[model samples]
Target: MPGRVFLTTPVAEIAARFGLDPEPVANEPPRQNISPGQTVVALTPEGLQHMRWGMIPVGRVNARGRPVMETIVNARSETVFDKSAFAGTGRAVLPVDGWYEWTGERRRKIAWRIRSAEPGLLFFAAITDTWTAPGGQVVPQIATVTCEPNADVRPVHHRMAVIIKAEDVPIWLNGSEERAAQLMNPWPDGRLVVEAATGVDWSDT
Candidate 1:
């Protein structure tokens, strides 16, 4: 699984490639370290916008009607569509330069950066929602959807984010649930480049 993600591409370039309006993120700066709870740029049917990377399950419940209280950073594709806990959630695609995963023991762990060899962006399928705080503040949240790892990712992790093709972005955002469900799978093998990630500050950023 990807423990973290990073985006170094410029916002305007990202907008041009994805056909999203650049106004909302025209001034967004390049970020090499993106973690959960931070704001991320996502593409939805409405357009590109910023949303918190973690989802706080407010009143959502499971199939048995039990409350789901965990703050989700990622949702498994296996249950995302049919899960009652995710009912009525909006869809989105999170564009990023790459993601990081780790291996080995806790203190001796190794970090690996995984990105597409094709070089533009990796679009991760995501679910979106909005949480209303007790004080009346609204926070838009999102969580990446994951599936069984592809060959490129299996060596480092057993799960990987659902990477959507550029042409399929619209389908993911506006297609029927069945069609969108079809897009939640691993990227093709050999398209990704994984290398040792160094110089990162694990404590922050």
Candidate 2:
């Protein structure tokens, strides 16, 4: 499964396509090192906004009142509705220009980038939770919803994000979790293009 993604789409374009007012934040900044815990833009009822990449539930704080663990960054799409982590009102969209995957022999890891076959953004379905801290402070967290790999990605990874097409965005965002689950299967062939890496070391930290 992909752990890092890149979004090169201009912020204004992303916001316009998703129907959100663009923030003053500088136009789409290329994200080459989108690791977990990094802030990323996500879609919500309040419109598109930025949120922490990892998901931390409300009461999971530790002794010093900090978050208890590394955020739950990705949720398997098939199990999201059933898991306590993303049940109920959980829903979101993790838009990306594409994502990076690592593959190689034995211990070597090579990185490859996957993007849409055409010029547009891809929306990875996700779920978010808003939790209130012990001090009554609230914070938002999210996890990317994942699905079984499509033919193109099966060799590189066993899981892939549940990509929501433009037409399905409303259903995914507004329908019941069960309805959203119904859309979690691997997309049809040709929906994505895999760019193989020729000679790149993806194992470097």
Candidate 3:
């Protein structure tokens, strides 16, 4: 579900690599572990910005018409477009050095760090939404898109984040919905390296 990730690369380096202008707000430190509800960097139409990890849909409301906070951290790529909350608004990417996943029996689980073997830095296809509170405050939130796990990731989990290639950044950010949907597939096997992570806590690292 891509619940935890780490970003050791400087934000400027990631922005430069993707040609993202204006730069991301330097509001976060180099994190070895980040969980849901925390702020994270994302490349959006407003350039680079810090957004809450779990997306709160735009139209969530209570009986009194007050905004409700919903934590949606992962969107399945297969049906992202079909979901009203994600359709048409699912655009963005989260850059990270790697992500953590666990395997083995419930009591003997082991954490594994998975990352690209070549570039090391990878981008997770994501979606964002701007929700307004009754107090007139606007908050931007994001959720990662997930796809069927590849051979390397299947043993650890049934799903994995949709990893976008560097060359397809433009298409993912501004391409047609059909085109974007085409790119929402599992990353090819062998491009990723998975290893046991030592001395790292998935909750807070």
TM-scores of the models, in the given order? 0.96, 0.82, 0.88
Misplaced by over 4 Å in model 3 are: 58-70, 202-205
* Deviation (Å) of 69 in candidate 1: 1.1
| Comparison by lDDT, 1 against 3, better one | 1
lDDT per model, in order?
A: 0.89, 0.75, 0.82
Worst 10 residues of 2 by lDDT: 196-205
lDDT of 1 at 111: 90
Candidate 1 all-Cα RMSD: 1.1
**Which scores better on lDDT, 2 or 3?**
3
**Per-prediction tally of clashes:** 0, 2, 0
For model 3, residues 1-205, the per-residue Cα lDDT tens digits are: 6879988888877777767663456655788888888988888755789988987665654445666466689989977887555544648888899899988889998889998888768989998887687899888889999999999888889999999987887788888889999999999999888999887755573
Q: Could you give candidate 1's per-residue lDDT for residues 1-205 as a string of tens digits?
A: 5568988888788778767689987777888788998999888778878999999998999999999999989999999999999999999999999999998999999899999998689899999999998999999999999999999999999999999998998899889999998888888899999999988777766
lDDT of 2: 0.75
lDDT of model number 3: 0.82
Which of the two candidates, 1 or 3, achieves a greater TM-score against the reference? 1
TM-score for candidate 3, please give it: 0.88
| Candidate 3: worst-modelled 10 consecutive residues by lDDT | 60-69
